[model samples]
Each structure stands twice: as structure tokens, then as C-alpha cells.
Target: MLGIVLPAIITAFSLLILDWLLPGITIDTVTASVLAAVSIGIVNGVVKPIIQLLSLPLTFVTFGLFSLLVNGFCLWLSSAFVPGFEVRGLVGFLVGPIALSFLSTTFGHYLLEGRTPASLPEA
Candidate 1:
């Protein structure tokens, strides 16, 4: 489905960019990037919700900013399962997810716009 595949691709692109931009985030190859992207997608889909729920009070106290930390944790967790996808140190753990989130969101919005029904006017 486009819904799933598109996000994965976007995440991969984001990872590639992060690999280039950040010294702490190292993706060894294109294959590694794709694998990391898929791993991150899975983590975000499955694990992130549980984390959000468990940290609901903290999220509320932080006025939803704690969700960013949750995202970073998910990214760090994905790196552990993905070979050749290394996130070094605390900085990588924190910034990688935020960068990936921004890139994926931007690319998904731009790329999927034409495929979405909202792009079409009512009959």
C-alpha cells in the first residue's frame, strides 16, 4: 500500500540525510538505510503508542513536548536492532529522531499530496 511504503521511503531519505549531516548518525550503506527506515517505521507504529500512553502524565506536564523524547527513544531503539545503523552518544539519540521526523513529514506531505483525496475538489 502507498500509505505504508511511502512513509518508509520518506524515512529512508531522512535517515540518509541524517547520516550525511550528523557525525553521530552513521548509516553504512543504502541497504542499511532502508533497513533502518523499516525498523524505525515498525518501532514508531508499535512501540511508540505504548510509550506515549505510559508517559501520558509527563507528556501532559511538558505540554506534549515529551513526545519528542519518546520519538528519540524510538529512534535509538531502532538503531539497536538495525545493523550498520549506528547512533552514537546522547546527541545522536536526541537529534536523529527530530531530524527524521521533520524530513519524513515534509517529504510525505509534498510527495503524497497528489495521491490524496483532499487535493481534489468536491463534485
Candidate 2:
């Protein structure tokens, strides 16, 4: 779907930028970026639901704030297997989701979707 692929590309590029900006985080090439993106999608699709289900009580107790930890864990897990994509230490791992989300949203709005429609015609 256009929605999914667009955001994925944004996340991949954001990871690349983060690697350049942040030491100990490295996304070496475009190939690595693609791999990291795919791995992230798989982890989010397959692992996240199970994690959320298991952590439901904690999620409720923390007012859903602990969900961020799950996102961080998934990011770390995806990075572990992807070559040339390395996120060292807790800072990179924890901030990964936030950075990706921010970048993806910005990129999606500005570059991918190309601004909101000014008007809609009647069907």
C-alpha cells in the first residue's frame, strides 16, 4: 500500500540520518537501510502484538507509557540482525522510535502526500 511504503522509506532515510548524526549508531548504506526497514516492519507486525498482549497489565498500570519500551525493544531487535545498521547503548535504542516517528510523519506530510487537498468534489 502507498501509505505503508511511504512511511517505511521515510523511516529508512531517518535511520540513515540518525546514524550520521549520532555516534555509535550506523547505517552504512542504502542496502542496510532497506534491510533495517524490512526488519522493523516484520518485528512490528509479528512481535509487537504478542508483546502488547503480555504486557497489558503493565501497560495499563503505566497509563500506556510503557508501550514506548516495547517500541524501543522492537527497534533494537530489528537492528540486531541487520548488517551495517548498529544502535549501540540505551540512548539510541530508546530514542529510535521517537526519531523514526517524527521523521516519518514529517516526511510523509511534506514529501510523500504532498500537502492536504484544499477541497473535495461531491461524489
Candidate 3:
């Protein structure tokens, strides 16, 4: 779906912001960006549900903090798939994905689908 794929692509660019905002994480180029996006989407798609299912109790117990770990795992998994994208160590591994989740949530909420809150049909 274009809805999903395009947001994932945009998320790759958001990685640029994450790297800038934090440190020790890098995605070197458009190629790496695209690869990271696609790989992350695939990783999230295939792995996230399973992780969520397995961690459901923890998710409930922590009031969703474990979701951050799942997010970080997806980023670490993307690092495995993309050559030029790297998360240097544990700190970056933990912070990078959570930061990325924030960036993607902000950007995707405002930018993607070409519709703002003012333009949407009323509930």
C-alpha cells in the first residue's frame, strides 16, 4: 500500500533528523535511506506483531514501555539489512529507534496523506 510504503520512505528521511538530534547513528545516502526504510518496514511488519503477541503481558504491565524495546529491535534489525546504516552500540540501539518513532509519528501525522486536521472530514 502506498499509504504504508510512502510513510516508511519518509521515515528514512526522518532518520536523518534522528541522527542529527542524537549521535552515533548514521545513514549515509539516499540508497541507504531507501534501503533502511524498506527493510525497517519489512522488519516491523513481519516481526512486530509476533513480538507484540509474545510481549503482550509486558506491554500491559508496563503500560506500553515494552513497545519501545520492540521499536528498538526493529531498528537494530534494519542495521543488519542496510550496509551504510549503522547503530553504533547499545545506547544508540535503544535511543535511535525510540527517537525515530517520535520523528515518524510527528511527520507522518502532519505531512503524509496530504491532509491536515483542518482539512479532514468531521467525525
Highest-scoring model, TM-score: 1
Q: What's the count of clashing pairs in each model shown?
A: 0, 0, 0
User: What lDDT, from 0 to 1, does candidate 1 have?
Assistant: 0.85
lDDT of each: 0.85, 0.81, 0.80
lDDT of 1 by residue, 4-117 (tens): 666788889889998999877999999999999999879988999999999999999999999878988888899999999998877787887887778888988898775664
Give every collision pair in model 2: none
Query: 1-123, model 3: which lDDT tens digit per residue?
Result: 555555766788888777677775888887888888888888888988898899999999999998888878778888888998887776777888877878888888777566654555544
- Each candidate structure's TM-score, on Cα atoms with residue i matched to residue i, is 0.86, 0.83, 0.79
How far in Å is the alpha carbon of 49 misplaced in model 1? 0.5
Candidate 2: lDDT over CA atoms?
0.81
Q: Is candidate 1 or candidate 2 better by lDDT?
A: 1
Candidate 3 wrongly placed segments (more than 4 Å): 1-5, 113-123
Ranking 2 against 3 by TM-score, winner: 2
Clashing pairs in 3: none
RMSD of 3: 4.5
**Candidate 1 error regions (>4 Å):** 117-123
Model 3 gets an lDDT of: 0.80
